[model samples]
Target: MDTSDILKKVRRIEIKTRGLTNHVFAGEYHSAFKGRGMSFSEVREYQFGDDVRAIDWNVTARFNHPFIKVFEEERELTVMLLVDVSESSSFGTQKQRKRDLITELCAVLAFSAINNNDKVGVVFFSDGLEKYIPPKKGKSHILFIIRELLSYKPKKKGTNITETLRFFNNAAKKRSIVFVLSDFLSDSYQDALNIAAKRHDVVGMHVYDPRDKELPAVGLIQVKDAETGLQQWIDTNDKQVRDYYNQQFSQHAQYCRNAFLKSGAELISIRTDEDYVKALQTFFLNRT
Candidate 1:
């Protein structure tokens, strides 16, 4: 697309997603993630309902009274959007492609963070790291990220979740709220995800298409692998063939679930045609 077209697309997404944040997600986002990073503010006399675990023994002994440490939520937070820009994102049988949905999702999240006075960044990746936008707060930064999401093309086509996770963990030293947007087609990232989860608050947003889950019985058809550029013919009418295809998707899904569970992270799935706003709202509510 041309520059003007890209700008228009960016503006459209901004209007839509920003509105969602303002009306629906603003409060939810804050309530869900705000109180995570707390800092010691002061020591005060313990209240009747105070938790004994928070007692400040040093202060209590000096004052000859029960005292508790008070902590305030750190206002500044950094949210990272780890997006998958692999070849498969281009394929969607619905009204929108996975890339398109991913762009909108990122836009909504960015606006929500900035609205809550949090800094947001983005990482675009394929088999290798594509680009990194450092964490910054403001509408301008979010607009710039939206522009890149709609226009930036990846140099590679395959996906390596491990590579991206490792790079992100090493680069971002501070603990962050990370949302990884992908279809979960890769199979070798469980170890890397575990490491990331231990350090950061990780959530895997699995964006997929209906076709990814099931094969339509269209008699016979030829399919091409978007990443490898390989073509193969398949008899979709054959029940066994369709079942096998579905089994593969199921296996990938099961692995994705197990990986996130083991890492103590969160995972949510979205289809290209699904209402992503609702899905995100549900997730934020669960977090709260």
Candidate 2:
């Protein structure tokens, strides 16, 4: 896409996602993710319900009145969007491609983070890291991120979550809220996820197409693996073939669920044709 087209798309996404953030996600996001710790705000006269432990003896003595140190949650946070830009994410037989859905999801999260005064960044990855946008605050940074998501072309077409997670562990110096959005088409990343979750808050945003789970009954068809560039013929007419294909998809889904659970992280699955907004809202509410 050209610069003009990219800017238009970014503007569209910003308008939609920012509205969602303001109306639906702003409060939910804040409740879902907590601040690091409490910080002292100021000193004020003691109130009836104020905690006695917060009493400021020095200030009380000078004023000859009982005073308490007021504190507030340190609400600033860094948010990382670990997005899959592999070839597989380009597929969808519905309203939008998986890539498009991922873009919108990232946009919504970015807006939500910014609204909460949090810094937002993104890591576009395929078999390895494709691009890293350092965490920063501001509307312009978010617009740039949306533009990248809409136009980024990965160097590698494969998926390798392990490498991506390892890179994230080293790159993010401070703890962050990480949303890893992918179809979970790759495996062997459980160890890396576990390690990362130990330091930063991790949540897996599993995005997939309906075709990824089942095959249509069209007798026979040719299919290709987007990541490996492997082509093959399949007989959808054969019940065995359909069953096997479904089993494989189920196994992969199970593996993903188990991995996130084992790592003590959260996972939210959204299909390309499904109500992603509802899925996201439910996830945020559940997190709360």
Candidate 3:
């Protein structure tokens, strides 16, 4: 895309997602994700009902009076967005393409992290790792992320979620919150997901279009596999063919649900045409 067009798109997303982050998600985001641990703030005179274990023995002995250590949650966190730039995300027959919806979702999450004073980073992947933006805090970094989300193109078109998760595990040493946004059309990623979830807080966002679940009776149609670039003709008018297609879609959906469940991760499903804001709000509220 041209520089002017990219800037325009970034500005548009910033205006929409920033407002939602400020108004709808600020509190929910804060409550859903926790800090590293409690850090000592100061020591003060012991108050009634204060925990006895919090007493500062040194300060108490020095002052010849009881004092308690005050501590607060260390609220800084690193949020990683493992985004799938596979070609499958380009398909959508709704208000926007699946890729566009994913971009907006990433923007909202990036803004929310920044609003909470947390570090935000992104790992863009397809069949392989495409780009890695190290975790950092600041509005400028977030804007750069949004800009990349809107304009970056992937070199490969296939999906390999395992590669993305493995890259994350090797690159990030500290515990972080990872949101894997993809259609999840690949297989053999269970082990990678299991390992990553044990190390980080992992959430899966499954993006799909309604047409993926069922096909319309539009007679024979030519279909193309977005990832593989294979084309074939299908008889959508035949009841048996339609039924088989629906069944396959359902099986894929079930696999995704079970994969997340087995890994002890959360899954949020969003349709391309639906209001993703409401879906995200519900997810955050449930976590909180």
Candidate 4:
């Protein structure tokens, strides 16, 4: 895309997503993801129902009165967005492409993170680690991330989720809230996911199109694999072929769900044509 076009797109997304972050997602996001731990704030006079164990003896002695220690949640956090830039993300027969939806979702999340005064980062992946934007806190940094998400082009066309998870594990030393957004069309990442979840708070956002789950009865049609660049013809009119296609899709989805469950991670499915706000809200509420 041209410079002007890129700026325009970034500005447009910033406007829409920033508004949503302020008006809708801010509270939910804060409630969903908690801080690392509590920190000492200050001591105040003890109340009737105050915890007796929290009494600050030193402060009470100095003030000649009963006082209690107060602590507040340390709200600073690091949020990492692990986005898949694989070829399959380019296929969508809905209101927007899967890639577009992913971009919007990332923008929303970035803005929400910034609104909560958290550091935000991104890992763009396709068969390998494509790019890594280090975590930072600021509106400009969030806008830069949104711009890249809108215009990024992956060097590879395939998806290797294991490699991506491994990279995330190695790169992020501190525990972070990681969001892995992908179509879940790849394989052999269950072990890596489990390992990453042990070190980080991982959440998988599975972006998919309805068409991928089933085939229409449109007779014989030629289809191409986006990642492998392979082509074949299938008779969608045949019940067996349609059933097999649906079964395969179901199996893939089930595998993804099982992986998340076994890893003790969270997962949410968002369709390209559906409203993601509600899905995100539900996920946050469930987590909280």
Candidate 5:
């Protein structure tokens, strides 16, 4: 895509996702994610229902009355989007491609973080680390991120999620809320995922298309693997072939879910044709 087209797409995504953030996700995001820790805010006269444990004995004695210490949640945070830009993301048989859905989701998440006064960054990966946008705050930075999401072309076509996770662990100095957005068609990253989760708050945003789950009864078809460039002809009309395809998809999805659970991370799966807003809201609420 050209500069003009990219800008337009970015603008469109900004408008839609910003609205979702402002109206729907702002409060949920706040509730779903906790601040780093508590910090002293102020001291005030003790109220009837105030927690007795918070009573400031020193202050009360100095002031000759009951007083209580106040603390507030430290709201500022750094959010990192670990997006997979492998060839598989380009496949989707729905209203939008998996790449486009991932783009919009990232935009929404970045906007939500900005609204909460958090810095946002991105890591684009395909078999290896393609690019890393340092965490920063501001509308312009987020817009630039959106633009990159729309037009980024990866140098490699395969996926190495393990390497990507390791890179993130080394790159991000401070703890952050990391969202790994991808179709997750690759495996053998469980160790890295667990290690990262122990350091940073990790969440998996699993994106997939309906066609990924089941094959249609279209008689015969030639399929090509996006990442490996493998091609084969399949008899889709055969029930056994279709069942096997679905079974494999299910097993892959189950593996992903188990990995995230073992790592003590949350996973939210969204389909390309589904309303991601609803899915996200449900996930956030469930987390709360």
Candidate 6:
């Protein structure tokens, strides 16, 4: 896209997502994702409800009065968005493509992070690591990220969630809130996911089209594999074919769910045609 087009798209996304961040998600996001831990702030005169263990004996000895140590939650975080840029993300039989939905979601998340004074970064992957934007704070940084998410092209066309998880685990040295946005179509990533979860707060956002879950009874149809560029003709009218297709999708979904559960991570499934704001708000409220 041209520079003018990119700027317009960024402005549109900012208007929509920034508004959500300010009016809807800012507080919820802060509550849902906690910081590292409590940090020492100061010591103040003991109150009736102060914890006995928090008493500062040295200060009390000097002042001849009970003083309690005060601590506050460390409220800054590093949020990483691990996005899948494989060709499959380019497919969506709805109002928008899967990639477009992913882009908007990423924008909202980035804006939310900035609103919380947290650093936000992104890792785009397609079979292999494609791009890594280091964690940074500020609106300009987030705008740059949104621009890249909208126009950057990937060097590969396949999905490799396992490798991507390993890459993220190594790259992000500190504990962070990691959001993996993808269709969950890859395999053999369970172990990697478990390892990542052990260190980081990992959440999976599964983005898929409704058609991915079932085959419509539209008679003969041709389909192409986006990643492999393979083509095939199938009889969608056949009950057996439709049943098999649905079964495959179900099995994959089950596996994805099980993997996240086993890893002690959360998963949010979203469709391209649905309202992502509601889904995100629901997830945050439930988490809180």
Model 6: colliding residue pairs: none
TM-score (all chains, Cα) for each model: 0.89, 0.97, 0.96, 0.98, 0.98, 0.97
Q: Model-by-model lDDT, in order?
A: 0.93, 0.94, 0.93, 0.93, 0.94, 0.94
Q: Candidate 2 regions off by >4 Å?
A: none
Better of 3 and 6 by TM-score: 6
How big is the positional error of residue 144 in model 3, measured in Å on the Cα after superposition? 1.0
Per-residue lDDT over 76-174 for candidate 4, one digit per residue giving the tens place of the 0 to 100 score: 999999999999999899798889999999999988988889999999999899999999999999989988887888999999999999988988889
Clashes of 1: 0
Candidate 1 C-alpha error for residue 104, in Å: 0.7
For candidate 1, the per-residue lDDT at 247 reads: 95
Q: How close is candidate 3 to the true structure, as a TM-score?
A: 0.96
Off by over 4 Å in 5: none
**Overall local distance difference test of candidate 1:** 0.93
Pairs in clash, predicted candidate 3: none
Q: Give the range of the ten consecutive residues with the poorest summed lDDT in model 1.
A: 29-38
Candidate 6 lDDT, 1-288, residue by residue in tens: 999999999999999999999998979999999989999999999999879999999999999999999999999999999999999999989899999999999999999999999999999999989999999999999999999998989999999999999999888889999999999889889999999999999999999999988899999999999999999999999999999999998898999999999999999999998999999999999999
Candidate 3 wrong stretches, greater than 4 Å: none
lDDT of candidate 4 at residue 244, scale 0 to 100: 97
> Which residue segments of model 1 deviate by more than 4 Å?
39-71
Model 4 score (lDDT):
0.93
Whole-model lDDT, model 3: 0.93
Candidate 3 contains a number of clashing pairs equal to: 0
